[model samples]
Target: MKKVLSMMMVLLLFVGMLAGCTSNTAPTETKEPEALKMGLVVSTLNNPFFVTLKDGAEAKAKEIGAELIVLDSQNDPAKELANVEDLVTKKVAAILINPTDSDAVGSAIKLANEAKIPVITLDRGANAGEVVTHIASDNVAGGKMAGKFIVDKLGGSGKAVELEGIAGTSAARDRGQGFNEAVNGTGIEVVAKQTADFDRTKGLSVMENILQAQPEINAVFAHNDEMALGALKAIEASGREIMVVGFDATDDAVKAVEEGKLAATVAQQPDKIGSLGVEMADKVLKGESVDSFVPVDLKLVTK
Candidate 1:
């Protein structure tokens, strides 16, 4: 009877231990790892669009209690590579990058891949390397929207000039492709196209030059709002009644449209892109698989 009682008590203690309900110790739950670190590499913050993007990512990170390390490439590919290296050294769980140049960013993406870190490309894509996902608005559709706006407004016949974004970026390539396609069989002739490097100052100067070179300019399409506003200034100075269409309906661009100064602008949700990127990165850290491409919505904003 003594042996039997001793064995039963021992078995009860073992069961209590397994249940994690011993009298001396309450039930202990497994805590989530506190180090959910993420890294964001932005091409440049000089542009309002990218600045807004950074803000969105930061906000989301704060909401989710994740640590976000932001590095700006200043539109330099070498700097972009260095930034990725820095992130890798920090051993971040995931990386988000807005590439300055699609082809030039391949090396940086490869570095992250070697480190076994997942990468999410924002706004632009890499020409090479493995990326877990790419997030952005439908740039091609936005470009087509801008082009179609001009085509229909001009009654399908007009002369226009395109002010492109950074030459080697996916945004530039896709937008230009869609725009060109929209104008291809129509009477809308793209007499001259120029690169403004997506800079407002450069856009103003380039448009000034194009205005002089192209005698008949009925419309203009800039890849972004900064360039569009710049081109609008040039057109206003030249006193030419040219209809201007722009992408990235930023505050200034939307205001211009409302004031009847700018014809139209393609609106993209930059905030959504940034927030979604961070959410996806969090999911990746949590061992969740994300899709290869996540597209934000777009709209044509006009008066």
Candidate 2:
């Protein structure tokens, strides 16, 4: 009986040990996910050029495993400012902006600055506020190239019309400056110059009006492909053989060039600009120093 009691006591001790082991075991702890967020504010989605820019930024964001929030400003300065505010409210890690109006975007950039969020300008730039970097092609040089092409094609003496972009934007200003600088001493007279606001429809209407006023234009220089294509349509309808030069070698513009509709275009890689902007933003967030201006290369595409 004593031996039986000893065995039972040993079994009870074993059971107690098992219970203590079970009770002392700790539950596995779960970790929270790391935060990664990016914001993209486009000036306008109506234009195919800006759409391509957005696509590049999206592709880069996906590759880097970050969440990208895209907002279309619809070419409105107020809307752009509002969108920047919304992104700030969302506490995004960084922001990439293609401003509708370079000067008007200052207020929005200031807000981002106050919130301590880094801002990178793509394609377009802000006149005021701190930007981590500005990624774009040299528009002035591109415009000069286009001007030189026009001068060469027309043998340095011809009547030309200029289709300008949005008045307040840096692109329109810089491109016009370059074109003017090149054409000044070339004897290529600019008989008419007008703003089209960078819209295809506007470009069409504006070019139509310009055509009515100046019927004997030898060449046309449009600030962007949209305007160039519009001017082309007007020229086609009028049965005129005006040499047209455009910027932004968009896909449609490229096709137009291949078909001999557009004379030439200064091809700025919107995709590269977008991707580089995101890459720079990432580096800035990682405490890396980046250049104030990152210039993408440009090529003149012609038929």
Candidate 3:
């Protein structure tokens, strides 16, 4: 009898232990790493506008308790690809790419998709392939607005120069195209069209060369505010009173307009673009459907 009781007690204890082991779940998956990781790949951090974009993105990321890794491509497509690869290796949850070249970034986007990472494009977009979302301004319309402003201000008959942004960029190409289309039949001739690479120094030098040829240049249509300011400097040095128009309405450009230096600017709300991009990324991570393209509004600012 004593042996039987002892054996029964042992069996009960063993059964209880087995039940506990079977009832417990795998420690709740260790809380799933607790934080989100994001990557931002920009064309260049050289301009103040891009810097503001970086700042806005960082602020939003921090607000949402996410880790944001930002990289600058310096307008090099090769470097931009490398940056995207590095971000993928880091296992970022999502990527926000402002590509240097729209077509050049298509492969990178495909690679990210293959890696199962979501990509949100900012400011500029990929030419082809799948992107989670593309958030930018209506650059074509902005260019048209600039063209109208130039035509009305110059009375549709003036010699203008076009300082283009980075070659192969959507912003540069679309804006140039729309502006040209707007002034196509009008007498506003684009006397000199050259690539300024969206840099102030390059803009100044290019404008200087153009000035050597056409001293009576009437207006300048820079793809961005930086080049417009640079061209303004050159015009001032040459003692020429030329109407300067620009895009991207950077703070400096706004100040210039306020001071009667610039005639007009196409204001693309970059900070809003950054914030909206982050919000969309969060929505995507939450398993929500987002728009394929988010069009931020643009304004024509003039003094």
**Most accurate candidate by TM-score:** 2
Cα lDDT tens digits, model 2, 64-162, are 988899999999999999999999999999999999999999999999999999999998888999999999989999989999999989899999999
Q: What is the C-alpha lDDT of each candidate?
A: 0.94, 0.93, 0.91
- Per-model TM against the reference: 0.89, 0.94, 0.88
TM-score, structure 1 vs. true: 0.89
lDDT of 1 by residue, 1-303 (tens): 999999999999999787775555775689888857999999999999999999999999999998999999999999999999999999999999999999999999999999999999999999999998999988888889999999999999989999999999999999998899898899999998999999999999999999999989999999999999999999999998999999988999999999999999999988888999999988887889899999999999999
What's model 3's overall lDDT? Answer: 0.91
What is the Cα root-mean-square deviation between model 1 and the actual structure?
Answer: 5.9
Cα deviation of 155, candidate 3, in Å: 1.4
1 or 3, greater by TM-score:
1
Summarize candidate 3's per-residue lDDT along 1-303 as a digit string, tens digits. 999999999999999999999779446555566679999998999888888888888889989999999999998889988998999999999999898998999988888998999999998878876898899998999999999999998898989999999888888998998899889999999899999989999999999899999967888999999999999999999998999999999999999999999999999888888888888999999999999999999999988
Instruction: Give the clashing pairs for model 2.
Output: none
